[model samples]
Every structure is written in structure tokens, then in C-alpha cells.
Target: MSNRSTRARIGRRVMVHTPVGGSRSVMMGAVAAVTLATLVTGCGGKSQDHPSSSAAGNPAIGKLPQATTFANLKNVAKDSGADAAGNGTVAHPTAAVPVSATPGGPPVATLPDKELGGPTWVPVVETKPGWQRVLLPSRPNGATGWIPAGKMHTAHSPYVVKVDTSARRLSLLKSGQSLGTWTVAVGAPKTPTPAGRTFIMASLAPAKATYSPLILPVGAHSESLDTFGGGPGTVAFHGWPQKSVFGQAVTHGCIRVPADALQQLAKVPLGTPVSISN
Candidate 1:
């Protein structure tokens, strides 16, 4: 009945689904693989129970931004000027919207309006007239899909998180200005942190706050582990109590930041862009 006991139970449940061939020792001391959708309240205080997938429906075709070829869908990082301007745009689906492989194309997937009990806010990487190409929180890193822009709410996030895996550093930026840079811990060489552009998928306060007071799940998933802790191998930015781990590569795939850094990051809004580089 105590909070500690409750958290212990949750932690145990999450750790039950370890990697296929990995031992308990291998998973120990790594980031806890808590289920993103079930563990905690997200930015909007909602919880989701399913992963992003296709929904059965004939989606309405709206006026597309432009007549670009399907090839453009592969260019996930080519934002019209959002990334370059240092202020990325975020999109929120007003409803469960159908996603297309290309602008005005047939529905490939249906994007839920919420994830982890919060508003599903995704970074808009590319744009056509009535369509916006946004990052997806599904399998295959760097996945993107086009959705009708007219049916979504839009906002610009001034905060950007940059992690340099090679240097073991994390930087926070706002409005093209650096807030601060700190030494952080990245993934080990074998289970290396994936390098790409992702957004803050959700913010969670775990029941067991011993490992970290807060966890910021990103859109990216672990490349090495198909499943961890009874959930998809989703990576995150969290605090590590061990000071010695700073500036080291010794995690499963999460970025371990200092207490101060975590405090600052906890304020960052979900859907803000995060750029991880080698």
C-alpha cells in the first residue's frame, strides 16, 4: 500500500520482458524499460494503452500542400525552415487522423490523437500545402507520414535538445540560443544510442523515483533491443543518481543527465525536437 511498495511492483512488472537473449545481469543497471503508455500521466495528463498503428477507415482527401513525389517522404529531416530557424513546429491531430504515404495518397496508418494519456504532439519535419509530414513514434527509426494539415492544431516550440553521443554531452537550446551544456552518459558501444532527429514523446514521473525523478520518452526506440521491460525498447532522457557515470557510455540506450540538467529538461514541452548526433 505504501508508495515504495507500489513502485517496486511496477518496476518488477516492467523488467519482466527482457531482451530475447539478454540475461538479467545485462539488463541490470541499464535504463528501466517502463511501458510509455501505461506508466504515468503525460504532458496533457492522459494515458494511452496501444501503440501507433493503422485504423480501418476511408480517410478524407484534403487539399495537399504541393504535388511532390513519393520520394520526398523518405527525407525525414528536410523541414522547410523549422529546423534551420531553430524553432521547430509541432502538430496535434484534432482527431484520429489517417496518415498517408504521400500527400493526398491512400491511408497507410491512423495517428491517434493521444499517446501516454497526453496530446499526441509530433514534430512537423516537412510541409506541403494542406499536408504536414510529421515524425512517427513507430518502428523503423526516422519514420514519417503525411497528414492533412487542415485538421490539426499547430504550434512552435522554441526549445531544442541536442545530444552528442561521441562527446557524451547534452545541450539545451531555446530560440537559437544555448541555455547550457552538460556532461551526460550515453549508451554503451554495443547498445549505442540511435542518432537521428526525434521529439519528446511524453513526460513521465515514474512511481519508483529512485532511478530518476522524471523520464522524458522520445520518439526513437532502441536499435538493439526489440523489447525491454515488457514494452518496446523506447529510449529516454532521465537523471542518474550516480555522479561518476557522467560523460561515460554505459547505458542501454537512454541518455543520463545530471540533476540540474534533468530539472531544466523537465520543463521542456513535449513535441519539442531532439537532435542526437555522433
Candidate 2:
């Protein structure tokens, strides 16, 4: 674990998770103690530690999708063709392999020889031959891209998390059935929690000075703020010490859960689906 300085930027009004109103900006005052693995991606206002660039000379890829309407941003049902969830390691013939905008499409981002240990990704339901369409842990809430299937590895998770912002509730499910539910704290009106499909990219525990022992960073970001708590506006599922925060709209953009709720959620494997709704 280590410490780092980061910058915060102001953003637009968004009613993502729970509806509460005001100007939502990134919190930049605190010096957060973060795990080394987490620092590679979500920390310091950066999403991925791997450097990316456009690829060239690849006829095996196809066209890229528009950022405005990225497919797979909506609900990811239990059987979304994403049979497994796991971290990606670039095992291709070369470093800086192209990540397509769509399955078998042109490159949108490139992967490095090694990832700085980033988030988990789910392959798209219907993938092209030899290519896997995987969700990315980047901006715009729900982003997906394509990577070579042979270049990655994954594991399955039966657990899933569904959050209802309007009701201020968080539910844990195993194989589509509810295991438990808890009241939670969502984003305030100005910096409302974003709604969409995302996944647990990483499981982290801060060394000190935090309310929660575990932090589940999702593949989503705060639509209202550019950064918060030294992160690149990455929305996370975490716990708070105060019971008063639960069932309230009072966070920058993170889901504030209870201690007991976090304990149960801990059992969920990394890369599990996390759906947030209005």
C-alpha cells in the first residue's frame, strides 16, 4: 500500500443512483491509503494502468462501436453469453495488442505486455471467432471492447449484486436468487450514482483511515464528477461506519453499505456482475 496526490474536476448534474441535488465535484482533500494493486487502475484519476494505443495491420478485426451507444450497457442477465468473469493478462504474440471497438472490429485500445493488475472483464454474449468481446473498466459508465480470446483467462462467479437507487437498497444474489438485502447510501443529487451494468473489477482493502475494510471497485464511473477520493471517478461498493448514512443520498458517487452487508458481499468472487438501477 502507498499514498499519492490526485486532482478533482467539476462535472455536470446527474441523477444516477439516489436522487439528491447539488453541485457534485470530486473530493480532493484527503490522503487516502490504498492497496498497491488498486493504485494501478482506479486510483489517481486513472482507470487502467496499461498504456493503450490504436492498432494497425489487422484484418481479423472489424468496426468499432460509438461511445454514445455502447452495446451491453444495459442489463446483463445471468446468461449474457458472459459465461465467466476474471482478470485479463495479455498473453498475445506481442505486447500492445489491439483491443477492438467491437468483436473482431478495429482496435479502440491496445493492451500492454502486462497489466498493472486492473479490473475484471466479461466477454460479450456472442463473440467472433478467436476474439472475445469484453467489458472494459473505463469511462462512460459501461464500456466494452474486444480482445483475443487466446490472450486472456477468466473464472466464473455465481454471485451478483443488484442495487436499487430509488429504494436505496442493495441486494446480493447467487445464481439469480436473492441471498440478502440491505439499506445503503447512494450518490447525492448532484453527484448521483450512475445506473447501468458493471462488474467488480477489483477487491481492495485500505491499510488505514477508512470506514470500510474492503472496497469493491466496479467497471463504472461517476457521471457527475471526474474524480473522487483519489480515484478516476470510479464508483465502488464499500461500507461506512455511520449507520446514519444508510438509506440516504449522501455520497460523492459510491455505494455506502453496512458492515454486515459487506461481510456477506465479500464472499462474492471478483468479476461478478453488479447491476444498478433507478
Candidate 3:
């Protein structure tokens, strides 16, 4: 997996994939070579450490063990809620927090503290008495996991990103007000972008700054391609130098936005909810 500082050159027409899932890197110049890899299964690349089982506690009782993995947990249910107006909440883990399959079940993985070199912020989808269901960046799109709500800090994000693939448009909303909408590129027919609820997992700046000034990786992956450019087929929102690419379904799985749209999206914080609909 590539680190934040990993620099590499990509040619025009090459599918840009971040080394770590949920973090994308793009390069710009005459050649359009990019630095940084694409987003992976988790907000970061595969985790090297696992949470100590000795620290395990029941989430139903408001106690959680140390959290840790992007690969171990699966079968998480898809988030079916509508776009949160102004009450959307994001969670920031103070430490690695264990994720469980059920409220009192054994933990399946741990949530990390950071992703793409930035603080890890996950969107809370559902809330129980002691547990909060959060959207995970792992594969099998729409994957979700349960974490102890008391173990992490929470904040509200008024921003919501809505994408209409059929219309090839992207809209930004703040506090239920429309910020603006712009035409953007979507996934090709062969590699369609998976639609569902996700969050902005990371914001990255490449070394070259040619293709785009910044790459905003979302917590969603490609449905067709398991991997691309040596990274998990993580989808992202980024700017394309060619204005003609906007409003066209030509990308592998990433959303190619216009310069203006990218500028507006850059201000949106990570963990802001993104809703993609067909």
C-alpha cells in the first residue's frame, strides 16, 4: 500500500487508484502524472495491528474493547436512512475501538484513529442505547458495523453530498439548503459506481497538483473492480483537467468533477454524508 507521501506518475487515461482505500491521489501537468494511491477497503490501508482481545467488553453494556481491522468484518447491513438534514453526526475515535457484530457479541474488528494521514471520522447511521451503527469503508458496499457510542467523540456535520448518476450531476447541501449543483463524470457502464450512503473518508493533496489540486476520497468502492492500480477499487471525488469529461460516464469508478465543484467540495469536512442514487 502507498503512504500519503508516496509519489508516482500516472499517464493520461490511466485509472487512478489510491494505495490505501478511501484516500485518492492525482497528478497534474502535461502528462497528468499523479502522486498518492487510490482509496482502499478501509479509510486507511490494511491495518498491521490488531486489538488485544483481553480488552474486549460488551457493547450492549456501553463498554467496548480496543478496536482494530478492515478485512475481518463482513455481512454488515446496508444503511437505508435518507439524507440527514442538519443533524448528521460524525464520530472521532479517541483510541482504537472494537466493532461488534451485535450489541453484546464478540468484536470483529477495531476502528483506527486515522485514515489517509488524517483523523478518522465515520458517519453514524443508527443509534441504540449503548451502540452506534456506523458506515464502514470496507468492501461489500454499504457495509456497516456497531461501535460503542460512549467510547468516541461525536460532532454534527451539516453538509450532505447528493449524486445523481442518471443525470450526471453532483449537488452539495448545507443545513438542508442547496449550496450548488454541477455536472460531473460518473462510472462507465462496465464499472458502475455503487450507489448508497457513504462519507468523506479523506482529503488528499498530491505532490504534482496537475490533475487536481486535491483528491477527496469517499468511503465507497467500485462494485465491478475488486482492485485497480494496485489499490482496492475505492471510489473518489476528484477534479479532471479536461472540462469535456464532466457530464460523461467515462471513469472507472471515480467521480470526475469540474474545478468549481471540487473547490466547493474541498471545504466539506471528512465524515460528511454522501448519498449516491441511480
Candidate 4:
């Protein structure tokens, strides 16, 4: 048995050694002293074998989950695909290798909220290895802002940004891992262009086959967004407009990262990362 358990047995043995009534008072005092010592030991004071908390090690740690929308930022059901929940990974920003938590342990405890940073910091692999949720803290107070852990890698965390423009090919990157290349569309010379690091500000998969073609001529189909004032550079990477010349630049500025890529891109929530450039 564990050290604490063993000591309790010893205490019982000591009390059993007490003699007759003449030595009763003295033995009673000794038993009381031994009992007090046992209590302290059981609580993990002097015994090195006890399974105290410190000895158990802090095991409740993980990355913050991806939020549903950039609007209210709440926990909601996620979509399906490579970016599915538990599909997101932990990595050093790029070179990711998946990892899981110790099974049968306690669920994640409440942590603090921290400001989100990114849409600028881009790296294929993290120099220092560790996992940190973009929003959840990893500790109690100082850790509350965003939860981060060393055990997780790039295959089971969360992704906050993704883009796929169908010009000649498309590019799909999650968290930091890449799903290979894909052809995409770009805005024509007439349509300036909207290229920069952007996140999933919002998304909507209409109950019907809703599509926006006019203003987005020659580009991917519409996937409503919380783009600038919810318009103009309303960045959305989607499928081709049936009658539209998708392989050509015809957007008002939104980077036309092709349509078929939408299913994969849609997996990310608002605030997920995105990078747009020529």
C-alpha cells in the first residue's frame, strides 16, 4: 500500500501494544500522540511515499477551444472536415505532430481570458515547442488568459484562420499545418484587390443554395462574412460561380481563394488566422 496507508497500520499496531489499567493513562497519552502524527502523515506532511497533490503533478492542462463566431465569441457545435474539432493540432506554428491528453483525468478547469494576437505572426514551425489556446489561459490567474500545455502538438488543438484562393491553385493551411496546394482566383486589374492576413470574422452556409455572383463576377461563390463593415473587402474563399470565369481575377478586392476550398476553410471559427497577399 501507499506510505500513508502503511503508517495507519503502524499506528493501529502501537495502540494494540497498550498494557493493563495501571499503564492505561500513560499508554492512552502515547496513543494520542501517535494518532496525531499519523494524521499529519496521511495529509502528506513528512512521508515521501504519500500520493500528495505535489507528488501527483498538475495534470489539468490543454489548449483553449476555437470560438464559434468573431461576433459574440461563444462555444458552439463545430462543422465537419480536416479542420474538425480534435482535428486542429498543436505545433510550433508550422511543423506539427499530433498529441493527446492523459485519459480519464479531470476536465479542464476555468482559466482567464487573454487578448488574441496574430494575423501577422506566421511561421511554419514553432521554434519553442508548446501548445497555447488562442483564447483560453493555461493557468489559474496568470494562466487563465489562454490555456497552453507542453504535451499537445499540432494535430489536436484548434485552428483560427484559413484561406484558399482559386487562381491557378489553392493553398490550405490550418493552425500552421498545410493540407497541400490548391489553385485559386484573384481580383482583376479593374478590381484593386484585398490581400492581407485575415481571420474568420464570420461564416454562413445558407439553408438553401444562396449565392452572390454580380459584384463577385469571375470569382468564388459568396460565403457571407463580417468583412469590412460586412462589405467591400468581404473576404470569402469559396467555389466557382457556375457561369462565371473562376480562374480569372474578377473580384471587387476579396481574394478569390477558389470555392471547393470553402468546406475546408469554413471549419475555422471567427478570429481563426488568414493570410492574404498577391
Candidate 5:
């Protein structure tokens, strides 16, 4: 994990991801508009703090299978109800693994060994004999990349989350049963949040964000904003202290939640499904 500045450019504030896991809100709309576009979205300090490892290039492929839509990086066989199918098992990575552009293509980015700390890689979807396609934690949302299967270890999870932009709410479920629900802030009409089947790529605690203690960077991005907070407009599940923002269209593209709601969401494993809809 390199200590690179992961800041983003909001309307006028320069939301910086500090090397110490702290967030610095500097006003740089005029000073560094170009620089802000280069910052990553959430958990600024190191790329390792989040599961969406940095890769240079467009990761958009096409529509994937229904089940393969989200990142299966932490779903184990037993948890995925895979005792029967045995085909859609998610494999966790034992060591740092290199992501490929194609089934057996060149290296795009190297995934750190740690899975945002606890829940690591559970790569399913075998593409070829030696290669497997896993969901990437990148912008333009729902991106997938290939990696060597032999380099990964496997797992599963039974939890899932559903976010409804129309209703401005989020629901958590386990084995299809509701655990909890909460109001949330979505993107403004001009900067709509990218929807579809995504997953929790990482759980991060910003060193200095006044809103909440944690942030969950999802495998989605902003459809309108190209580069936000210096990153690739990557959408995330984060907290906002402002109560008024709840149940409203106020964010650049990220989903904003109350602090209490964010605590519960942090418990969910990385790579768990995060289905967002309009």
C-alpha cells in the first residue's frame, strides 16, 4: 500500500484523503481542478485501505451473468449455498495477486494480500483453464478483470444490501431476511449515482471526517461526474453529519448515511452484494 494522496474535487471543496487516514477539506475549486480529478474516491491514504485496487485503463467489458455481477471475493462455498452447485464458489487470495485485462492478459494492477483487513478476495467465475474473472473495485462501475485462480484462496457470505434511489433508503438482509433499514442521501439529478449490482469493496475509517467514523467504498461510480474528490468518481457508502442530507438528493454521487446506520453497514463483509436501483 503506497501512501498516495487520494483527494477528490467536489463543487468547490477539495476533499483530500490524507496519508494518515484523515480527511482534509480544502477549498481548491480554482487552484487545482485538474489535480482533484486525479484523486481516488474513498479511504484516501493507501490503495490497500480499499479493495478496489488501482488499475490504469478502462475496465468496462459488458453485461455479466446475473450471479457474477457483484464481487464474489469473500463469499465462501457454505455461505453461498454452493454445497450443491460447486461451480460459483468465491476464492480468497492468499497473497497479493495481479489483475489482468483479459482472460489471460497482461497485469493491470496488483491486489494487496489483505481484504480491506478481514474479508478478503473470494474470486469466482472461472473464465478459462488458468484464468478467472473477478469483479474489480474501479470506476465506471461493475468492472471485471481476470486473474490467476491458483493464486487465490476462497470463501462466501450470505448477506446482501439493497439501495433504492427513488425511495432514498437502504436495506440490509441476510439469507433473504431483513436486518435493518435506514434513510440515505443519493446523488443529485445532475450527478446521478451509477446503479446496478455492485458490492462493498472496502471499509475505511477516515482520519478526520466529521460525518462518520467509517466509509464503505462500493464497486460503483458517478454517472455524471468523471473525477470527484480526485478519484475516478467512485461511489461509496459513507456518512454525513448533516441530518438534512438524509433522504435527499444532495451528494455528488456517493450514498450518504447517518452515523448509526453506517456502523451496522460496516459489519457486512467485503464483496457482499450491494444492489442499487432507481
Candidate 6:
């Protein structure tokens, strides 16, 4: 995430199943140039006290923990049941999880129909028992499954996110679609926040991190973002300096909110759909 988020990398998780239905394994993959790629895009920031100069102006700043690097550790159900293609090693760290194509590959029964765009490298969301699962490439395709959940990660998670840098606030959206909004800190005058329609690709619990909207990637730890850049520094939502300046037009490009706001955003799921406009 630190440097690869801006590259031509694709990420997805290996799938596993369980009694609870279906789930995905921990995410793994290499997204070179993923998180900070759009840092140069011309997205704007928000502040009731001061607005951005870009098209996507004045996003609200919300509450977020004072973090420079954070992760949302997602547990997989364990892979006691993955198709057993052989021993597969996880890939380099990035926002997306990576599963090396097995040597012999999975069992024929476990493979998805190639025509249906079945089973390929995908970012794992949750894992289950006796099955490996992944996001279906297409609609009606839903999710692909394989492997058992016992050896992968864990099962299920409880957390959601909502970001409003223009208002300088983030909302914690629960499973019920409700949320708790708070303030946050974003990019600074040099490392301003980026703007675009983005979502949480991966997450990990926070450590001694200081950046808001912390993400969970592989090695260096970077969040997966699929936002369309508007211009140089055009993307929205990114980490910034945690300072006394919350409501002010201060950043190189991206919006700068507070710490609590980024923490709330860290909970959102990958591809969670965002619509940022002035």
C-alpha cells in the first residue's frame, strides 16, 4: 500500500465455506501503486470553515483515531477445506489479498466453470468451513466457493463505515444501516486527501498508527482503493496530520478531517460505493 497502490495490480481472496453459509478467506494480493497512486489527482477537501478548490469540494471531516498506519484484521474460518491445490503461499502485501495459483491447482470438482468467469484470484472478504470462496466476477455469479473454513482466517465481522470529509465527520455504519458520526484529520497541504468513489478493500486493527482511514493490506499495509481520479490530487479520503486544525482549508490535495472520522471509515467494506461531489 505504501508505494504499490498505484500500479496495475488486481486483488481478491480465496474462498472457503462453513455451516453459516459461505464466506471468504483473508485477502492477499499485490496492488502496486494502490493506495497512494491517486495522491496526485486534483481532488479537493472540505471544511465548513474552509472549502477545497477542486470539483469535489469541502468533504466533512469526522472523528478518527490518531493513526498513521492501521489495519482491520479480518479472521478467516481457517482453510482446513481449501480445494488443496498444494501448498500455496500468500503474495506480497497490498490492499488486496493474494493467493498464488497452486502448483497442481485445486480439484476439478472445486474449480468454477471457466466460461462463467468462475473462480479466479479475488480479494477474500470472509472465510468459512470446508470451503474456499471468492467474489463472483459477474452478477448472478455472487461469490465462488471452495476449501473448508477451519484453516483459513475466521468468520464474520462487525463494523461498517461512512465518510464525509466535507463535513469533517465520519459515520460508523452498523449492519443495520445506522451509524455514529465523528470528526477526523486528513492529508496536509502537501499530502492532501484524494477524491473519488472508493471503498474499503481490506482492513486491520490499529496499532501505533497515526494516519486516519487506515487500511489492511499485506506487507507494508495499504488500503485498497478503486476510485476514479478527478485531477492531480482529485481523489478524496486519505490520511493526514493529526493536529488542532480540523475545520480549515489546509492540505496539498486531499481533504483533511480528524482522527475519529478515519477510524469509522476504516470499517467500510471494499467496493462499498461512494459518491463524492461538491
Question: Per-model C-alpha lDDT, please?
Answer: 0.66, 0.56, 0.67, 0.31, 0.59, 0.30
Full-model lDDT, candidate 3: 0.67
Instruction: Output the number of the lDDT-best candidate.
Output: 3
Give Cα distance to truth, residue 209, candidate 6, Å. 4.1
TM-score of each: 0.74, 0.67, 0.75, 0.34, 0.66, 0.31
Residue-wise C-alpha lDDT for candidate 6, range 1-278, written one tens digit per residue: 11113222355321121212122233334332223222322221110111111112212211111011111112212222232211121111121122212222332122111111111123343334443444222211122223333323322323434445566555555554656655554333333343332323334333333344353221111122222221111233545554555554454323444555555565544334332222
Task: Using lDDT, rank the candidates from best to worst.
Answer: 3, 1, 5, 2, 4, 6
Per-residue lDDT for 1-278 in model 2, tens only? 01122222223111212222223222222333223223432222222333222233543322322111112222221233243322222122243355666565646554433223433344233357888665555565556666777765555577778899999999998866789999998988777898877776667666552456777777677786554433456678887766888999888778989888888988876557777888
Q: Indicate the TM-score of model 4.
A: 0.34
Q: Give the best candidate by TM-score.
A: 3
Q: What is the lDDT of residue 71 in candidate 6?
A: 14
lDDT of 4 by residue, 225-246 (tens): 1122111122344444442445
After superposition on all CA atoms, how large is the RMSD of candidate 3? 8.1
lDDT of 6 at 134: 40
Q: By summed lDDT, which 10 consecutive residues of candidate 1 come out lowest?
A: 63-72
**Stronger candidate by TM-score (4 vs 5):** 5
Question: Residue 209 in candidate 2 has what lDDT?
Answer: 26
Lowest-sum lDDT 10-residue window in model 6: 64-73
